[model samples]
Target: MKRKLLKFLNRMVLSIVIVVAAIALIVVLFVQFSPQFGGKASKEAIESYKNSKNYKDGVFKNTKDVKLDMSLKDMGKALMGFFKSQPNTKPEHDLPSTKIDSLNIANYKGDTRLVWFGHSTFLLQTQGKTILIDPMLSSVPAPHPTLGSKRFSQELPITIEQLPKIDAVLISHDHYDHLDYESIKALKDKVGHFYMPLGVGAHLLEWKVDKNKITELDWWEETTFNDFKFVCTPAQHFSGRGLSDRAKTLWSSWVIQSKNDNIFFSGDSGYADHFKTIGEKYGPFDFAMIECGQYNEMWPDIHMFPEETVQAGLDVNAKKVMPIHWGAFKLAMHTWTDPVERFIKASKKEKINVIVPKIGDLIYINSLEENEGYKFWFEGLD
Candidate 1:
């Protein structure tokens, strides 16, 4: 009887090993060939990544020391929170958006007109050039269709095909929410140039974007197109599209300047000294679009609360500031309208001009007075 029991135990262990090996093999194949997983930096690109000042050991590092790795307790909280849903986490009604037409775009001779397509997506038409920033117009924010949050609204104000030839596309990082596969594929043929931080061009290259048009810059690097000068600034965030490639690419804020107008875009950052530094370097911005949503205390080092968002605007010396990174998807546990409400209150206290435009509504930064009275539009929804 003892001999029989030993033989049975050995067979069970063998079966378990075989199953584990098969699962490992499947995961390897998935990561290897799946287009959804995206392409890693090429050998040459990896060498460039290594040479960056921020690169240490094998990963990129934030200027200030930060811990990107979550504790096991925090991980436990996140995993448990996944099964629970927050009230008013998504909009109850379909949000309104203005229709965009080429004639309207061409005729607008005003100061930089920006159309926000919810969250961090913006279409800025200024000086006869159209720029698309963080164009994640996909319905979902994950690499796989079945795994992420669907967009709050049913459709975008303008489709990718309807867009005019894009002068440039700026990507902040390699997170799935910011750098979407579907949106990149749609814009690949129409974009004139793609600008991103170091090591991000790998994904674009894999997606068939022209290498000549792709220019990857390190932090503080500036590139020019026509009258506008685009500078890659710093942000306190991490980047990775998959499990194996965390922090392989850089994240950033951006400074766009022309002779007349200066704009700052805080891509995704926590409250940090970088904001003050940016303001001192390039002060009195005409407008600053700052991230103000999808934040929780659990990961306070990456995303900022709404109040911090306003303070960052003040830090950057923005004449008029707009809160973004909300309204599109619910990536955190906060109430859906919490971000804007908190932002408005904070802005009032700080005595800063706040621009609250509806999705797809065009707000000229030079004329923010016309964009007021949008208060409580997002209120009363559960």
Candidate 2:
């Protein structure tokens, strides 16, 4: 009887081991072989990262140590919080948007004209060049449709296919919400150059973008397109598209310097000293587009509160500030309008200039009109 029992126990253990091994193999195959998760950092890329000040021990690190409130208790609270949805998390009616007239926008010879397509997507035409920044125009921000937040707006101002010949596409990071797969695939043929932070070009390469069109930069690295100089400045954030590979790529804010205008795009950053450092290095910007949405107190070090967004704009010495990263997706627990409302109040207190344009509204950088300031477009929506 004892021998028979031992044989049964060994069989059970072997079966369990086989099952676990199969599951592990499946996950590895999915992460390594799947094109949706993007490509891993190549050996050449790894060697290049070895020389970067931010990369160490096979991962990228922020200048300041950031500890998220990920304690077991905090995570439990966060999980519970997801079950309780806030009122007005999404707009009651379809959000308003103006369809893009590409020829008129492209041909208009004037100061920089910016058209916001909700969230961080912006089309900026300046110096006779058209640039798209963080162009995540997909309906959902995720690897799969079943897995992520759906966009608040039903239709985009312009489809990627309808876009004019893009001079460059500036990618902030590889987050699914920012560096979307479908958008990149549609834009590959239309774009002249792809500018992004280090380790991000791997994704473009995997997507079959022309290697010659891709320019990857480390922090403070500057590259020029015609007369426009783009400097990859630091940001307080993290990156990952899968369970593994966290922080394998770098995240950054960008400072675009033109002959007469300086524009700063604070790409999904938290409140940190990097804001002050960037301000000191590239201050008195004519316009600053800062992130001001999808924030939670639990992850304070990753995303900034609306108040901090305004403060960051001030820190960067922005002559005029406009908040992005909201109005597209309900990625947080707060009301959909909370970010802009809070940001407007803070800007008022700090005596900072802010442009609150509606989605798809064209903004002329050289001219600041009263109609552009504090348009409570989201008001009265249930």
Backbone atom clashes (below 3 Å) for every candidate: 0, 0
For every candidate in turn, the CA RMSD to the true structure comes to 2.5, 3.4
Candidate 1 deviation (Cα RMSD) = 2.5
Candidate 2: Cα lDDT at 158: 83
Question: Candidate 1 — which residues are off by over 4 angstroms?
Answer: 1-26, 106-110, 370-374
Q: For each candidate, what is the lDDT?
A: 0.87, 0.89
Per-prediction TM-score: 0.92, 0.92
Off by over 4 Å in 2: 1-33
Give candidate 2's error at residue 310 in angstroms: 1.2
What's the distance in Å from true for residue 283, model 2? 1.4
Q: What tens-digit string does per-residue lDDT give for candidate 1 at 1-382? A: 9999999999999999999999999878877887866787877777767778989887889998877778899888876666587568788777777788866765666667889999999999898788999999898888777778788888788988788688889999888778888899999998999999988888998988889999999988899988999999999999988768998888999999998799999998988999999899888799999999999888998999999998999899998899999999878888888999999988888888888888888777776673373566676665
Stretch of 10 with least lDDT, candidate 1: 370-379
Which prediction has the highest lDDT against the true structure?
2
Give lDDT: candidate 2, residue 351.
Answer: 85
- What lDDT is obtained when candidate 2 is compared to the true structure? 0.89
